[model samples]
Target: MSTDPTRETPHDLEAVDRDDAYAQLVARYSAPERVAVALDKVKAEARRRAKARQLVTRARGGLLHNHTVREIARYFRKAERGRVDLLQVSEGTGIPLTDSRQVLREFVDAGLLYEYAEPVGKEVRRSYALAEGGKGGITEVFIETEAASRLEEQENRARGTLGWGEA
Candidate 1:
């Protein structure tokens, strides 16, 4: 039997005090055993969320990083002058397969590199090289800043001073 009107609904008992309930909860969780369990649960949840975030980030990624292309270019510069497989380049550069494929295609189209296949006893293995006739103008493109060089090359190509006009 409670005196508080809120507690004495129709023909009911006392209402629970929020502060008392909270204090009880705090005391229960403050115990070492409870604290350890709670901490472990929190840490586990954090790890799960972190893994989810990484997956979401990779899945949602739209634009390819220029640095990734630069890294792949550097890989090509150091690679042997023979063709290498897509998997080999991806593994060596630690770039994702999809990204490596796209970048390599772009590089080939841009003539920063060339792509071909060589017979591997029974099969042909696709490969790439940095030498576009002699060597790719990686430094020229990336060093001059991608945007500015693109603009410059556009003007130069139009004026018959570079790219297809050069040859």
Candidate 2:
């Protein structure tokens, strides 16, 4: 009840002291758990943001269909490091080639698909695989010589003879 104009009122001082004390308590008690909880919240928010971005992209006429995306992702996931070209994926998933290409490009932009290159004849060919965690999205490009291609063709024929499924 001091009358000094410069002096903070008891209620004002109490409120600030209470806030500081609460902050100190939060920092000191269950600190690790609190940190983990905060981190989880941040990650969840980021995921929500990514989903929103996906939606917005679709709304903007970007061809971001959930069914198509899921089909493409599943196709690559099943491939499991094996590369598949666009035409093969399109045919397997029953999605048109144009739509498949757009979807695959979107997945690549979203960090959910990996694009790579392999040689076919004298020219290099582009292919794709599913991105896993943060490691699988990186493209692996290599040149395949004629001998290598011939060897691969022989292996592919051999696999065909054994009745293996294509990715």
Candidate 3:
């Protein structure tokens, strides 16, 4: 029974101490039988890296640093409304898809990247390009348009209907 007199309740009998319950959970998952879960994660990451390397090899490009924002900017140097899918960026840059997406997002926020939706068939596909002024002078209209495009792309992504194209 709980020590509090006013809190009389039948469910109180089933309540376990928080610390004790946490320790039990830790012990349960730490058992040898559960160690495969950890190993499986490592193996999965290895497979992803191997696939990324294969893609880099197929693209005939050197692997860039994992998280270089400058490299991404440089990739868009000659782009004026250049159309590129997210998977192409991932393969060309040799960065993981999630990381490349994040860096692109940061570039978008910094006005170095211009994101827009290109109509592909019946659905709109997202793409990015370098701002016209070379990141020195981004117009207010460009910023607003890019911001709206990014928001709409995010919504499409969440809905899982927007295809990023061959990865």
Candidate 4:
């Protein structure tokens, strides 16, 4: 029984009214045990749906965010190993320097990148390389390749599902 008519199907509203009437009648004449069981069923169904929705959301977020981070880290590692500077990374990746720096920082924070200081005459210059456990210094290139491959696979699956061809 929603106040918004558009939200309440005719059948749904009828069911709600019928349920309300039954509840009033039960309170007046039915055994307390029957009412308690009915309420418990409703509560259990609501809990189940809520849990399902939460699980879906958590799964989606984990896939999207974790994949993005891993892919970005792989890109940075490849660029560093190739002797590409930050400017080159910005241009080649088509990500602005600021955003690229942020992504790189995350990899550093995650311990996927090793940071070191190269001493200059007056100031120290910081540089990065792949951490010992990572795929050496070629992580970025590998990640980019892997991501492209995955995307292609996804596209092919989608086309197959929809009866479409490569466009």
Which residue runs of candidate 4 sit more than 4 Å off their true CA positions? Answer: 1-71, 76-84, 117-125, 136-167
Task: Give Cα distance to truth, residue 147, candidate 1, Å.
Answer: 12
User: What TM-score does structure 2 among the candidates reach?
Assistant: 0.41
Residues 1-167, candidate 1: write the lDDT tens digits. Answer: 66666544544423446556888998887897887998986665455444323322332353445556655756766545577778888998888988898877766655556688889999877787764332324443343334433665788878878653346
In candidate 1, stretches whose alpha carbon ends up further than 4 angstroms from where it belongs are 1-63, 117-125, 141-167
Please, what is the TM-score per model?
0.40, 0.41, 0.35, 0.35
Predicted candidate 4 versus true structure: per-residue lDDT over 1-167, tens digit per residue: 55665566657966678779999988877667888888986665455444323322332355323333444545664443733445555666666767666655555554455666677789765566665444432343344445655665688787775322335
Per-residue C-alpha lDDT of model 3 across residues 1-167, encoded as one tens digit per residue: 77875665556753446546888988987875577887875665455444333432322332432224434544554345466877777777676777677767655655455688779899877677764443332232233334444665688889876734413
Worst 10 residues of 4 by lDDT: 51-60
Task: List, residue by residue over 36-88, the lDDT tens digit for candidate 2.
Answer: 99898667545544643553346234345545655565566454646688888
Candidate 1 structure, TM-score to reference? 0.40
TM-score, cand. 3:
0.35
- Compared with the true structure, the alpha-carbon lDDT of candidate 2 equals 0.59
Colliding pairs, model 2: none
As for lDDT, the candidate ahead, 1 or 4, is 1
Largest lDDT belongs to which candidate? 1
lDDT of 1: 0.60
Each candidate: what lDDT? 0.60, 0.59, 0.54, 0.54
Residue 20 alpha-carbon offset, candidate 2, angstroms = 37
Off by over 4 Å in 2: 1-63, 77-81, 118-124, 134-167
